[model samples]
Structure formats: C-alpha cells, structure tokens
Target: MSERIITPRNRGFLFLDAHPAGCTRLVNDMWRSVAARPAEVLGEDAPVALVIGSSSGYGLAATVAGLARAGIRGVGVSFEKAPTERRTGTAGWYRTAATAELAEQAGREMHFLNGDAFSDAMKDQVADLIEERFGRLDHLIYSVAAPRRTDPETGVTYASALKPIGATARTQTLVFDEDGKPDVREVSTEPADEDEIAQTVAVMGGTDWERWVSHLAGRGLLAQGFSTAALSYIGSPLTADIYRQGTIGAAKAHLERTARTLDARLGELCGGRAVTSVNGAAVTQSSTAIPGIALYTGLLRGVLGGDMVSPVDQLSELWDQLTGVRPLETDEEGRVRLDTWELTDKVQDAVAERWQAATTETITDLADLDWFRGSVRQLYGFSVPGVDYSASVETDVAWPASR
Candidate 1:
C-alpha cells in the first residue's frame, strides 16, 4: 500500500476519520507516561485483567497502565470498525493495534475481541478464552460508553438520553466559530421522560457489570482475589443538572448501587471486591459529546493548569489499589472519587466566577480553548507534537492481534 497523508475530517466535536500514525504515537506516549511512574513489583502473581471497552479513553489508559506499570496481561473487548482500502478505521481500532504492538515489545500477552460487548456471545467467548489461556480472572475493568445497548436476553435495545430529570436545563456550551476558534454558546434541554430515564439506565447503568460478574462466578472462573471496576463520572455544578442530576446521573446512581451489591456478592464467592471508579473529567470522545462538558472541561483545564490529573494518572492510581500498593480511597457511598481536584471548593469557586463572565468575547481568556481543541483533536489521532499530517501514510493498518 502506498503511504498518503491523512488529515482529520471533523465537524466541531465529531470526527469522521483517524490517522493511524497519530494513534500509534498516542499509545506510545501513554505507555511512556505510565512506565515513568514508580510501580510495585507484582512478579509471578501478576493479575490477569479483562478491560471491556478498552480501545479509547480511560479503558485504553487503564490497559496500557496495567501492562506498563504492573506487568498485567490479559484480554480486551471493544466494538470498532476496521479500516479498509478506501477509508480509515475508528480511532479505537488504531489505538488497540498500537497497544498490542506495545504489549508485544514488553513481552506481555494481550488478546482482543472486536465485537459487541453488550451481547451474551461476547461474554461467553471471553469466558472460554479465560478457561483456555489464563486459567482464572483477576481484574475486570468496565469502561463501556455507548449511545445504545440491546439486552442479550430480551433483545430490547435501549438508547441513553442526556437530558435533565425534572426542570429544564440551561447552560453554556462550546462550539467552533468560522475562524476555527472556540466560542461560548447557550444550550437548553427539556427534562427527560420516565421512559427515557429508564432507557438511559439500562444502557449506561451497572446491570451489565453485575451480569458479567455473575456469569463468571457461575462458570467458576474467578480467582481467589478477583476484583472488578466500572468507570463513572460526577461533574461539577456547571454540568450537574445535565449530568450528575440528569438522566445519565440516574444511570450512574444505579451503577453505584450495583457496586455495593456486587461487593458483597463477590466477597461470598471469591473474597473479591467491586467498586465504581469515578474518574475526573477529561477531553474524551464521550465527554466532547455531552452538552456542557466541553465548556466545563475547558474552564477546568484553564484553572487547574499543571495540577490537573490526567486519565493515565488516575489509571496508575487504580493499578496501585488493585495490587495492594495503595488502599482504595472511597467516599461515604464506597465509590472511588477520582474527581477530587475538580470538586474542591477552591476550584469550583474559580470556575463559577469565570462561568458567569464567559461569553464569545471572553472565551479565549476564560477557558483553555487551545488546550481543549488540541485534546479533542488528539482523541481522533491529530495535533500530536511530531506527527506530520501533511506527510503520506497508510490508513488501512491491521490490528496486531486477531479479533
């Protein structure tokens, strides 16, 4: 195949194509970041992890961190489109390929399953793999973020809504102007109906996480100290009405409840643990789509500057907790709060002050628009420091491991 330059094709927050080299660079950078940190030696008893939705964002970060920092090797499950001769693949596809390459370099065994993670067939396949390859499962990381899900049992598909719960929600959002600059815009959404709330919970809630644990336990594949973590978020006041208090918030609350139930269930079965890992806000593919998250994260980046904790940083901490290098810090509800810095009173006060004064004219000054743009672009494999976007490259790159 002839190498060709691949530039990003995007509209504001939605990207249509991904650069393979850019994605490869991103995976390498994440590996180097986690490798630089001090990690406890797990040696022969290293955990076997299964990272569902492990192609992008925190899932990908955790996969890389587990392998680079703790020598964890296991399987990952994600649903992504493969690249062909005429077009590019999804960003997650390229990212998984790059991660597989890194794992090979480090003498770690990493397998991948590219298909619907919400189906019974995928779960059964993973169970078979565990029995055949790893013998037992140590860690299961659930970081799935999809717009819709079809129940494997009933085949009923539920789509998640991002609207508020009771009253209408009005907030400031971010959009790109004609000059390709970030500008503040106002957005309002009506409250979601009861059905919408239920659907959102069905798709994004912890029911599936519980199902996976139950399935594994039924198959008797859990290790002596098996652990599971499901990723979640609780935004600040700026996005609380549309996020933490909205339809998705109801889903997250359900996820937390499931965690408590599973915590006890796992203890009885395998002396295991279960918890919701509430990650901090960052510019991810999922976050960029939420109504007010773009503006909120931009302002957050501006205020926190160098003190902000990144996805990889949080994943590193998760590895410590999973391996007994550090204790799991929890809120009153037993959910891990990784958004501590963002929720601090000082940070919230500064953000609120700036939020009130923010407008098109003051957007550049009030928020880290440049950083926001760079981060969004980076998610789809663009805006990296040394990548030559104008240079020729191949788009139909194959994932290192078979699906």
Candidate 2:
C-alpha cells in the first residue's frame, strides 16, 4: 500500500483517510508530550479506567493520552463500529487501537471493547469484564455524544434534529473563498419542538454517565477515591441559541446536574468523585456538523494564531484534574469549568467583536485559517507522521485484526 498526503480544503466537511501509521505516530507524540510535562499531582500507578465513547474525537484521544501519561493500565469500552478499508475507523477507534498497541509495546496492559454503550447488556458485559480482569476501576470518563436515545420507560426511540431556537435565527458564518478573507454570510435555521428538545437532552446528555457511575457503584467495581469525568462545551453566544440554549443546551444542563449528583454519590462510595470538563471548540467529526460552530472556530482560530491545544493537551489537563494535581474551577452546580479557560472571556469578547464587525467584504485572516486548518488536519491522520504523503494513498486500508 502506498501512502498519500491528506490535506483540508473548503468542502465544509471532515476529509478522512485511513492511515494506521499516522495514528500510531500521534499516540507516540502524545506520550512524549505528556511525559515531558508531567503533572505535579499524580494518581496511583496502574489504576483501572473505563472510557465510554472511547473510539473517536476528544473522548478517544483523551482516553489514550490519559492512560499513557498516568501510567495507568485499564479497559476501554466504546461503541465504535469496525472501520472499512476505504476509510479509517472513526478517529476514536483508530486512536484506541493505536494507543493500545503502543501501550502494549511499553509493557502496559490494555483492552478494548466495541459495542453500544447505552445498552444494558453492554454495561453488564463491561462490569463483568472488569471483575474478571482488573477487579476495580480508578477513573471513569464518559465521552459519548449520541444524537437520540430510546426512552427506557416509554420504549420509544427518539432521534434529534439540529435547528435554531425561535421562528428563525440568522447568523454569520465564515465561508472560505479563493481570496484570503472569510466570506461572511447570513444563515438561518428552523426551531425544534419541545419533544425534540427533550429527546435531544435524553440522548446526548448525561443520563448515560449517571447510569455507568451507578452501575459501577452498585456492583462494587469502582475503586476508592476514584475520579470520573465527562466532557462538555460552551461556545460563544453566537452558538448559544442552538448549542448552549437550544436542544443541546438543555441536554448539557441535564448533564451538568447529573455530574453533581454522581459526585455526591461517588463521594459516599469510595470517597471517590465525579467531574465534568467543559472543553474548547476544536474541529471534531461531531463539532464540525454543528451549524455555526465551524465559523466560530475558524474565526477563533484566526484570532488565536492557530496555536490551539489538541485533544492530547486537553486530556493532560483532564488527567491532572482527575489525579488531584490541579484544581478545576466549578460553578455552583459543581462541573469542572475547563471551557471557560479554553474560551476565555477575552477570547469570547474578541470573537463577538469580530462577529459583529464581520461582513462579506472582510473575511477572517490567515492566523484564523491556520487554527481551523490545524484542527481539521488533526481530525484525520494528517499533521502526524511516518506517513509518506508524496505517493498515491489507499483510503481502504484494512486493520490488522480484521484483515
């Protein structure tokens, strides 16, 4: 198989290709980055951890990075489907395999489970697997982002559709043109109904987190003083209507509440704890699909000079919080406020200013473009190495196990 060079263009979607070696290189780089800057506080060595939504995006990368940095050997359970030859496993799946392979090479124990995380059978399987293998869990990370969920009580499967809040919401988006500036265009979307909002909350929100925590707690599988965390995001006000205030916002609110409840329950169990980390807006397979986030991220990237932190960096911070080395800011509700730092008041103010000033005549600059490009590149196996981009590439590269 010949390697190919993958680059991002203005098609407005994530360009994906399977590059196992590139994925492995990312894992290696992440390990080096974390080891060079070890956290001041550290958790017990080789503590067990379980990551749901463990196959892609921030969740997958975070799981790999956290395990490598903390020197913890644990089981990873994700609902990632197997990858096709023409395309990479979802970013998370590739990263999971890459991380596990690297960890094994480093003399660390690791395991991967592929299945639906929201299923009761899968949950029981995970608990049983832990009991049969490691006996206890020290950390739990919930990274799943399903758009719809089945109602356990009603036995109805509800899927969510994304749209604006009111009659219609108009927003500016950065559309790349051949000319350097981002073309600002007004975009509008319809509003979702009350049932849709509720369903969205049920699916994408924190109920799964609570279920996992409760399941582990009830089964006595959670270790004493363990730490559990879930990822959340609060973008600028531009996206608040659809994201922070709309269906997703409602879901996040539920998740935030779930975090607090889990924290108290876990505290009672092992003196353990539960936390939620609000992450910055980075290009993920998921985040890109959101209406105005791409423009906001692109604009923020332009403003910030494209030096945004990668999933590995965020994961390091998450690990630091989990191990009690660094203190995480929490609201009255008790969720770790990482997003506030990622999208600082200064940054938000600047973005808002740019958004207001944005017009078709004036687009974003190269600095912002760089940020967007960097994130987009990282989503696929680009920017990481051992990939020979000069040659024609095969999109359908099969995994070793499947092959």
lDDT of the candidates, in the order given: 0.89, 0.71
Best by lDDT: 1
Residue pairs of candidate 1 with colliding backbone atoms = 4-392, 4-393, 5-392
How many residue pairs clash in model 2? 11
lDDT of 1 by residue, 1-403 (tens): 7467787778778888888888899989999888443544454566799999999999998899988987887899999998876678999999999999988887777898899989999999999998888889999999999999999999999999999999999999989965687678899999999999999999999989988988888899999989899999988988999999999999999999999999998898889999999999898999888898999898888899979998988998888888777887778898888889789999999999988989999989989888998899999899987898888888877766543
User: Evaluated with TM-score, which candidate comes out highest?
Assistant: 1
TM-score, candidate number 2:
0.86
- Cα displacement (angstroms), candidate 2, residue 197, comes to 0.4
Candidate 2, 134-225: lDDT as tens digits: 89998988888776666554677878767655557667666555543456687787888887787787788887788888887789888889
Displacement of the residue 114 alpha carbon in candidate 1, Å: 0.5
